[model samples]
Target: MINRISAVFLFLFFTLNASFAQQVLTFKGELAPIGDRVEILTDSNSTMSLRSALSSKEFKRSSGSQFPNLGTTPYSYWIRFTLKNESNSKAMGIQLTQSMMDYVDFYQVQGDSVTRTNFTGHRRPFNNRFVKHQTYIYQVPIIKGESQTIYLKVKSGKQLTLPIYVGSIEEVVENAMIIDLLFGIYLGIIMVMLLYNLFIYFSIRDITYLYYVSYLGIVMLTQASMQGYIFRFILPAYPEIADMFIYISTSLIGIAAIEFSKHFLSSKQYTPLLHRISYIFWALYGIQISLAIAGFHNFSYTMMLALAMVSAVYVLYMAVVIMLKGFRPAKFFLIAWTGFIFCVIIYVLKDFDLIFHYNNITNFTLLIGSAFEAIMLSFALADKINILKVEKEQSQLETLKALQENERIIKEQNVVLEARVIERTSELHEANEELNSTLENLKQTQSQLVESEKMASLGQLTAGIAHEINNPINFVTSNINPLKRDIDILLAALDEIEIVGLSDSTISAKQLRIKEYKEELDFDYLKVEINQLVKGINEGASRTAEIVKGLRVFSRLDEDDLKKADINQCLDSTMIIANNQLNNNIKVIMEYGELPLVECYAGKLNQVFLNIIINGIHAIHTKFGSTSGGELKIATYADEENVFINIYDNGIGMGPETQKKIFEPFFTTKDVGEGTGLGMSIAYNTIKKHKGQISVMSSPGEGSQFSLQIPIHNNQSLSHLN
Candidate 1:
């Protein structure tokens, strides 16, 4: 009777225990977010024992989000959840969505004993995880009728984001595959953008493209590191390196982005204050990197956040300023950076727990923002060409209007002069002096206008000249600081040697001190650098001299008369002067045949060459642009009758109608002020004075060639009289 009662009691005890424990959260067929059903316990000191945690009833139900925003802390969190196999399957998998946690410990609990199920963390070697993936995945055993209670311990130097999912093996595989495919598509888009921008950079040599590509590349790397792709696929054994790379890439992205903004918006030209602020952000990025290297991650992260905010704001401000000043591309720039700034603000808020935590939003913010910005900015860059085209058209229209007005004024003046002449014919002697003075004043006014127009045309070359000279000067200037530091180091070492000799130390001790000082100074490194510094200075000087020589040759200021000159030399000098205007995309070919020295005004010949070469450059740029290929050919030959010189370009050629009017005064294919409508006319007149002929042969889409035939020597009468 007693045994029967005991057996009945045991049966009741087992039944009650099963009923209480088997209240499980089930994963049907899909991976599920372990939501508020889980219980969370905060171990504020990070020293809670598993026995104490399981025994204590302090765990509270989690909030609704799959991932909690705990901010940055040194505390550990203990999470407990119950799962049962509602399906027929006997196996299931658990996955941790957070990839950046420093230490994660999973345990399976049974009666009075806890067994570690899996361990993973960013601080641990990536290969030590239960499953090799960007996400921490662990296998769990499931029985048809039994329940399992799981416990998790998570702690990190970074913000704590705990998102866990449970699913069948097939479901896990499917989810992973879906994620990888999405990432693949995302990365593929980034790569295509990188390549496209690089191609543009190569085609135009725009510094803006260079900066944008670098910024995008660094941003891609940062996103990849954050998502654990680098740790999973690239450095499985070095999660620490992956973590470090995240901070470093973040810092570099700020720098590149600011540089891109500066160039794209022309901040230096339009917003000087914002441009200076950009430099401050660059310095902040540097400091952030240094802090990361020193292992002050929290400080570095804060710095990174600040740098990003400052840079984004500066870019936006500069874009706004440029747009207000009538820059069309700035409109798109403003929109692109707005998306990026919004993402950054949201992510930062989320990190600090100022906003609700959403796993997908926080994790994918940068990726989404970068992708959107890159695409938008690319469109913006492409739209820049259209803006330039519109501006060019506007300029042409204004020039045409100015020319028409000037012609009307001239015609009115001519009518007045005719009327005055007819009226004054009866008093011819009395009016002669007044007419001469009026004519003289008119000549002076015309000369002043011509000079003003010529100055305006030449002023375009000034910036290019400054750019050419500044490079070599910058090279020299950049080296001076390092050279100075190195020299100071050497001198300090020399003074230390003298102090050692004057000291009362023994010979061996003195020798030891000298050796130590030399090593500390990196004596061998300094020695080599000194030589490099000198070599660099010399090269810089030589480059500067070459630029000066090119300038002198182009000007021909000292030799203005009709002197024996090499036409080939004249062409070379003209090319140097026009080098800044020539499309980098075009190649120039020189073909010179034997020719005698042609006696002509060196300055005038230089002017003719300048006009023709500049025109060739403009034509090539208009046709093939800065992306397509083009060639300009200059060939010189001589026959017994004349010296034949040809300037040709494989560019948009003119038709017979345009060619017929090319040499007429105030006639031009270019914008009115752009050409002065006098270049070719002046060339024709100069050739005529030299007893030479100038002509052009052109057809639509076929290329234009301007040919000049000059006598080996000018007429003695014209030469002497002039």
Candidate 2:
């Protein structure tokens, strides 16, 4: 680097390029920026020495570009500058910002030859550098009030953006330390985001967070590689690894970013076409990595940057689509990605030299953008947590409302049935006294008993419905309190963060305090617990929704109307309602076949299935004492015009005598109050009403199998059944 050039220009230029005045830098202070105060001569074959460059007389100063950046040039660049020091300090050095330059040759010119020569570059081992710095630095022997001409040659297999600085030992150390401090703060933000999100990811087992964390990691690695820290600290001995790190990381970063967007925005769910398109960009990034591996550095870097811009735009567009479709989380995602894309746009522009001034601000634009994006994306993830909590609450409320409405309906129906039962009993008693005949009174009582059997079936149905709905509601209610508590903790943390962020105090001063607060709060533990609570609530709400759906199918109130219905569905709905009675014992297996819709009373058929299932369950209990080793199988098949159902249970069976009596009214194997003695009888009657056939087969100690055949085309009149 040229610390201070004297008033006289050091290198002669081509006549056409010699329009500018003499270029010289005289150092009066400790440190100075030699960023653009030097002239460069490009040698196509990299064969220029100090004496030859001095004789070439073709060096030209860049007029507009701040940092002399020639992107990925394999040739050589000869920079000539005159430095004069007027200060007392003589321990002056030249610093080259680009760490990946393959070789750097510094030649101190005295008369026509080099007086002092130093060699250092990326190709040299860390221990072989003139100075033990991450970047190239050469100690120049310059006395006070003396001017010297310095010639430096640079060549690399990477993008060449050279920002040179010249300063004394004290000044350079001070500058480096300040830069380190700024980087320290940036690293802190990244670490915080990684640890916090990583905890949540493990707790909830959400793949979106995995992608998000991976993206964070890749960005950090890529930025570190570009900043030379990866070489300085991570892989100092292995220059090859550090040289390839940036290319690999750049490809992986795009992949991670695309995956994170695809899931977080639910792009497949909202914009499937666009989601498919993301893969193209991902494959393109892969190709870029391949090119880099194949040693096409310049082409690959250009392709990588182009693809990055295109993919960033695609992701932003996807987020917008999802946001417009009412995905709440996409709002923050959009804002975050937009800021990052804006920065990327500028970085790409500067790298291509479309933006004239290529300084540190443009060079590290991606880093700044990434830091902002990471923080905002964390907010988005947190917002999703709140959304889930609210959705769970809303779901529970709706379920409760539905439960209340169903209870009211059931109660009203019960009241009507009770009145009918009372009136029938009164009329039967009056008839017994009026007729004074045993046969007549017995017949009336038998009719009332059948009606009572229906009421008992209704009671079992209601009980089953209540039991099925209870457990999931219990799950939901149990989590509400814990969920609220965890959410409050997160909100408090966020509030504290906001307060601290808005404060005017320096970050480093409060850094230790922040660390202490994190330990005390245990953000990791809280994030995990909160994710678990939300998941539990979601599962509960999902179960409740399923119960409601089954109930709707099972309790079709329009029993008198003939509607086309799938028998398999009717069986499933019955199973859902009868789930309570099954407990953990009696394992039920259902094999349902494709069946045409049958025009019949769906409610009546649901009742028939329920009665049969309940009876089978009771038989299983009677046989095995409900200690769990019983199986009940229900299968359905269909023929040309009929659908058949076969329900079998491995339980204590009945003989021919009991089988004949099973379908008769007022006959049951259960004790007095245990059953109404009309379950099978009613099932038989309901099948008869649908012009269907019912039969049963059993042995004394084996099991019972009941078969029913119903016509797929039900053309019979049902007025008699009503």
Top TM-score hit? 2
Best candidate per lDDT, number?
Answer: 2
303-411 per-residue lDDT for model 2 (tens digits): 8888888889989889988999999899999999999999999888877777534776886688799999999999999898889889999999999999999999999
lDDT value, residue 520 of candidate 2: 83
lDDT of 2 at 474: 87
Candidate 1: deviation at residue 247, Å?
Answer: 1.3
Model 2: per-residue Cα lDDT at residue 666: 69
lDDT of each: 0.78, 0.81
**lDDT for model 1, on a 0 to 1 scale?**
0.78
Q: TM-score for every candidate vs. truth?
A: 0.52, 0.55
| lDDT by residue for model 1 (1-722), tens | 33443333232223334325333687555678885578888999989976566566677778777776666766788888888777766778888777778788887654433434566787778877777888778777777766677888998766577777788876776777776787788899899999999998898887778888987888788778877788888887887888888788888787878888888888888888877877777677888889888878767776677677777777787888889998778999999999988888777777776764657766677777888898999999888867877888999999999999999999999999898988788688667878999999987876675555456556867887787778788879988999999999988888999999999999999999999999998899999999998888888889889888767766667875667888887788777777777747788899999888888776776777777777788888889877767889999999886899899998899998999899886788887557677667667777888888999998888789999988887667454211
Worst 10 residues of 2 by lDDT: 1-10
